[model samples]
Target: MREFLIIGSKAKTDKFSLNDLPGAGRIDILCRCVSSAFFLSHDIRRDVNVYLLLLGPPDPPKVIKIVGREVKYMPPDERGIAGLIRKALEVKADESWKKSSPGIYVAKKGLEELLDETASDVYYLREDGEDVRDFETKDGLFVLGDHKGVPRELEEIILSKAKKIIGIPTKSLMAEHCITILHYELDRKQLNS
Candidate 1:
């Protein structure tokens, strides 16, 4: 399965207002990234995993994992998505790594820990990196940053751990857009192979 990690530098760990998801001021981008990661054509979903490294709130840092195939109900809107994530976090805050539902898990581990545990090859997405089309397509983990981009310290760690630094050869797309393009490219390559 393909894995995508989104680092939310200011995403709150606490519960947020469902009515004001965009105005809630904590998880707007996080919600958007999640929505993009899971959305597909004709309501079909992709078999993938999304990891959110939330760095805002009372707890500071927390990792939220969502499995696509296991998701019982995926919200089409940012508000509902944010609510789902908020509820998941609230229900699984204490667990180190426990399933709150069929497709969702909350873990105490941060980005570094999660990357180390995954057996898939890790690829860090950046504009200056090599073009993805030129690289061999395979099941792997793709690490991305939120609006503000990955933190400097974490980027350093990611660079060291990544099997490759892949680029899209554009002016830098949104995290979700990057996912879609990468999946399309990889899927096409797989089909041809």
Candidate 2:
């Protein structure tokens, strides 16, 4: 499976209204990231997983895990996905993951703990990294930052753990766009294989 971990540096951890997703530290961006990660023309990519690492006010460091294979009732729109995230935030969580809704899990885990849990090859997405077109695409974990970008300290840790830093051979792009491009590359590789 392909896994995506998006670092929402300023995304709110507390519950947010569906109407204020963008204002909620650009939760809209995170929602879009989710949509891009799993949604296709007529179906959801059940083999993918999207992780949102939210670090914002009131409460911080909430990780929202969306498992595609198990996820049901996920709407194709941004507002609908945001609703799911809002509901997840409402559920009280500890270090352990708590299921708030179908296929959505919330926890108080931060970046370091999450890195420890994933056993897949970790690839950090950066504009200056190796061109994605030059490498083989396979099942692995892809790490990226939201609009605010990953924290400097956390980025250092990511670089240390990443198997390689991969990028689309272009100028800086939006986080969601990067996800779409990555998915396209992976899909092409899958089809050709």
Candidate 3:
């Protein structure tokens, strides 16, 4: 069934982020960092602990989920890191957890926070704007959510991407907790083995 949130809808993927989450990891690695950026050659390299990030066509935008935050939107460049300034959280965030990795965190509450953001940025790319820009690459002048306020259709796609990568998070893997949807998948994979 399709699960719809207050302002969004979730088309159940065949799977979710079990690949890049705790349940599926060979081992677990977790961390506690809000968000960070490395000095890349051009713009800043901001890495949001996003559960999902999607960039679609026509108009380009992004949807991302960060630690303690819910789904939110941002404008990213074609080849740069995510650009997320702030967001209006849809749910209460969970900041309490074991430190693990950048943007990735562990919390007692599973998906407790829901931000209105995303890492999937899409724009016309044919056009440009103030604060709205894209990077020209060999592929094309692809647009990104270089700013904030991404849309929902793109968010779903990112969530869909998270569905594919399979593995346990490096740190902060929850050995004892309510079995998340992710855990169920990991269990099945183990059983198949």
Candidate 4:
């Protein structure tokens, strides 16, 4: 399975209106990342799982997990995806994950805590990192930061824990674009094998 952990450095942690995703600390970006991570031309990619770490005002850290294999009633558009996030934020969550919707869970864990619990190899995505094309094919927990980018302290921690720092052939790509390219590369490698 392909697992992704997208950090929303400024994404709001409270319920937000559908019309103001951008205003909600760019929750719109996270919504698009979710769409790119699992949705194809018609069907959802069941092999994929997405985690959103929201760190914004009123709430510093809230984790949202979307399991494609079990997710239901999720739409492909940003507004639809944001709706799910809004719902999740409305519920109370703690260190343990709480089911907010089908295949979607919310928790109050930071990046370090989540990484400590993850069993798979972790790949940190960065523009200046090693090219992903040269990396071996494997299922991994890929880490990405939203438009604001990973903070300096967090970057250091990720760099220390990640199995490898990898990137696509391009520079400064959007978080969603990076996810799409990663999936494409993985799909290509799987087909060739």
TM-score of predicted structure 4 = 0.97
Badly placed stretches (over 4 Å) of model 2 are none
lDDT of 4 by residue, 3-116 (tens): 999999988888777998999989999999999999989899998889999999787799999998899999999999999999998889899999989999999999999888
Query: Model 3, residue 19: what's the lDDT?
Result: 34
lDDT of candidate model 2 versus the reference? 0.91
Cα RMSD to the true fold for all candidates: 1.8, 0.9, 18.9, 0.9
Question: Clashing residue pairs, candidate 1?
Answer: none
What are the per-residue Cα lDDT tens digits for candidate 1 across 1-193?
8888988877777787787655543477777777777787656456788888888766757888888888877776777778778877787465377776668788777777888888889999998889989989667889988788888998998998999999999788888788888888888888999
What candidate 4 gets wrong by more than 4 Å, as runs, is: none
Stretches off by above 4 angstroms in model 3 are 1-37, 40-99, 106-126, 131-152, 155-193
Give all TM-scores, in the order shown: 0.91, 0.97, 0.19, 0.97
lDDT of 3 at 38: 21
How far is 17's C-alpha from truth in model 1 (Å)?
A: 1.4
- Write the number of the candidate with greater lDDT, choosing between 1 and 2: 2
The best-first sequence of candidates by lDDT reads: 2, 4, 1, 3
Instruction: Put down candidate 3 lDDT per residue, 1-193, tens digits, no spaces.
Output: 1011111112111122323322211111111111211222443234223332222221112223344222222223311121121121112224443333334322222121323222233212111222211122111111112223224564454344332222233333221121132223433554655
